[model samples]
Target: MIFFIILGAVFAAVFLLTLFFSMPAFQKNAPASSLGKLSFFDTKGKKHHPNPTFVERIVLPIFRKFLSIFRKFLPRNLVESVSKRLELAGIQDNVKVDVFLGIKFFMPFVFLLALFFISIFFKVPTTLKMILILLVPVSYIFPDYYLKSKTAKRQEGIRKSLPNALDLLTISVEAGLGFDMALYKVAENIKGTLGEEFKRVIKEMEIGLSRKEALRNLTKRTDVTDLNTFILSIIQADIFGISIGKVLRIQAGEMRIKRRQAAEEKGMKAPVKLVFPTILFLLPALMIIVVGPAILSIMDILKVMGQ
Candidate 1:
């Protein structure tokens, strides 16, 4: 027994040493270069380019090409649907959507690989195996759900902040700044969803788009009814040469009233929303605290009588 125990200990030590020595080599063999070579052109008809590293020149392009072909086999409609959903979720930036789709496309494979390793390591049962198989697809789509929820929350925040933003814009405009300049000033001062939207509007104007067009685009991007109405009012006022400050003041007042009503509605719903949790979670605990001592006393009395 002692001989066998010594042999097992030696085997274990050797195995650990081998694993430790092999890990760094395995990591070194893994690919590191993922991006393409960067190239630039000079003014005097000269081009500058970085020579591609071995992995970049040989391996990465092959992997990208293989991915391109693999992507062709995927359903076009499904990709389009995902893109549209992402657009609605306020991931309107093309580059971000591309990255998101790339991640989505790769995530299921990674999840399946993880599941494969886990099953191999743990010898999970068949029922759990089926559940993990389902989770692979779920993990792939989870980011989309998260992004949608974020977008909704952001939109709600913007809605809540709208009246204050409009009031500030009105004050700025009334203080002799042009509408575009007022928007720029408001974007600089504020720091939330409203500010972000206004910043985008300012950027569009800076890039030579008209104020009306930028505001209209902002409405379309946000899809908020109040903003849409505000934009329409501004356009109409612009067409008729009305005072912009007066228009903004009126709009701000209406928005403030709407916000107040929304708050009241939420307050009214709070009791109804609390009812289920109060009954399910808190009421049971309250009953236990109130009746526990009495129940214990009665049980003790019954025990004494039996004795």
Candidate 2:
């Protein structure tokens, strides 16, 4: 009887959710012609508009509501910090601060709901209960960790690509293009995090910011020491009437050397990193293969001697 009640509840929930999303209030203001088309997820294409799935229609309203409610409770400084971190992660183009905070708030409740349903099906041990309790806080903080990881990956990509970008910029400048023109050329040629940042700097410059100010903002956004030092060199060169090509050429050489050294350092540490895994996994498997037969033979001989 309880099983039937729970099953009915699930069906009713689904029906109500479907009805809620299908209502006129949740429908997009897009024209009728743009509606009823199939859309799929694409990494390089715009998603979630002009062709939203039923799930999106259902979830987006709740997501927006959560965002609006949570936005009021978030402090101004926290919002700004999160916005900056998201920008550093390259996701600010896609997700806003309010949406991010909404997810941060929403994920914990989702985790709790999942835990509740799971506990209903199976008996949760004390340890599992404690873990489920701990998961709420972990889920709440997961957005920040995800942002940090993305930022780290982006920074690493920029670090690897910066030298090549600088080299391209150097060549462009040496080829008689001005610094701004060189930036445009590099943005056109490169296709990674560094290229995107250069494009942003160019936009800032176009919006009335001085080259030095735009470059400084780039360093601030990236928080990369090598890039910051390179920016400092460019700023100093621009101030002291030094040649741009000379500065870029020197910075490129230094960045290339640093990248090589970093690669070599990581390679050198590979064996050290393998040590614990070798002892824990490979050694045990080897021992089982080599010693298993010997143990079995000894047991058989001992039984015979006893008889």
Candidate 3:
């Protein structure tokens, strides 16, 4: 009976969320068109939109109306923060801040409601009950955590890749290409978060942003220390009429040193990271395995003496 209730709650939630996700598909209640857009290209460069899916046609309009009731409660600053984080995570193209915020706002309550139903229908143990209570907050912030993790990983990749890109840029410049041409070369060859960033910078500059302004925007988007420092050096080099190749070479060396230092730091911390697991999990299990038979034999001898 408890299983049935929990399963029903899950299915109901999934059905509602499906409509909610498909809300992007509906026109004018237009997030509906997002998922159910059936957007496709006919050969010869033409596009077509199929009619909305049944869920979008029927349930999602009602679901959007239901979703709006909660949107009022997401504060302005919170929404702005979410938007900024989404951009940082590079997911702003795919996810609307409003939709993400709404999901974050409602998920915890939905979970608590389901758990409430389960508890009332079934006698949940105290330990499990406490764990469920703890998990509610985790469930609420999980999206935020995911975005943060993505942004951090992107920054780390940028940090590690900067030196190689700078070396390429420096080599290209030394090989007689202009700085802009060298940057294009690096973008052509480099791949990863840093390469993507270089591509964005090139596009920004092509679209009439001055080199200084575009590089500044690159720093704003990434916030990687070495990249920012390299940008700063380039900007100053431009201001003072220094050679960009020289700046690139210098920055490449410094970034390489920083990357090596970061690797060494991680190596230094590995033992510290391992210490807790070694003591708490491994030592206890090993001690029990090694001493168990001896202790059992001692207990048997003591029992025989008592007899």
Candidate 4:
């Protein structure tokens, strides 16, 4: 139709115009005239001369505005919850939970939209129509289950690594470095859950918080049983002016023993856990393979005798 043709032409024209206007911005290398200097156009169509880094000119503003809009819609309470969760997970720096919550909010809409399209395509049964609706919201939230599992695993790793990190800290402290410097040194050398917590603790100390207060905050954020005990030990040692090295060495040995005990418990449970699967699945298959031919031969003999 003439109307369709005109609409297509208009769309093509708009697309070309957009591509033309945007091409200069997408160029990998700046124009020869602007070599060693940065240039950008302002929103008002005026050429404002300013030095801009490649990321500042190309990426940061776009990402910043996107995050700003996203944050505007995210609930503060949800952000707080995410922040707390991240803190417990030992990720403390350069992340905003509002961004995460915004993604969470958007994910449900996207999943629902996908479900709507799938329901239309498949002509899903009326009896199961409710499942499709439920699946949309459920799938959206499914990622949180994965996130929680990862966080738990990371926390466990941190808990297991804490004693070693603490011993190193105690050594560094006893070797003439201040507690804060020792924390930094340990954080630098170690790479795990406890290392991340120590890194944040060091950052806090650098910002003027006392060593004890920072360690206490770390304990609160982690909520790990072993970490709590370790912090208490540190606090007590500080209060009594006892040598930290002795306390740390004892704690580390105890933690290693606990790790060994946990491993032994898991080994003990493995056989019991495997028994059900072996009985239910493998045993039946084995019995069928062993007795099947014998049963067939017995039936054949009986048939021959009757004949």
Q: Which window of ten consecutive residues has the lowest lDDT sum in model 3?
A: 26-35
Ranking by lDDT: 2, 3, 1, 4
User: What tens-digit string does per-residue lDDT give for candidate 3 at 159-185?
Assistant: 777888998998999999998889999
| Reference-based TM-score, model 2 | 0.74
Q: What would you estimate as the lDDT of candidate 2? A: 0.72
In candidate 4 the C-alpha lDDT for residue 242 amounts to 87
Displacement of residue 9 (Cα, Å) in model 2 is 14
- Report the C-alpha lDDT of model 1 over 1-307, residue by residue, as the tens digit: 3334334534543443333223221122111110011112112353445895664477445644655666567688866765565544555533333445555655566546555665666655677568658866875776677667766776787788788889999999999999988988988887776776777776666667888898887776677788889889998899899999999999999999999999999999999999999999999999999999999999999999999
Position 235, candidate 1: lDDT:
89
How displaced is residue 74 in candidate 3, in Å? 4.2
**What's the lDDT of the predicted structure labeled candidate 4?**
0.64
Error of 1 at 59 (Å): 12
Per-residue CA lDDT of model 4 for 1-307, tens digit only, reads 3334334534543443343223232222211222112113212344556996665586545644676677767678866777777555444422334334544555556545545555656654565557546655764575466457656876687777876787687788779887667878998898765675676676666667888998898787678898888889989999999887788777777877888898899999999999999999999999999999999999999999999
* CA lDDT of each prediction against the hidden true structure: 0.67, 0.72, 0.71, 0.64
| Candidate with the greatest lDDT versus the true structure | 2
Error of 2 at 134 (Å): 2.5
* Tens digits of lDDT, candidate 2, 75-127: 98988888788666654322356666766766567557656765777655668
* Pick by TM-score: 3 or 4, better one: 3
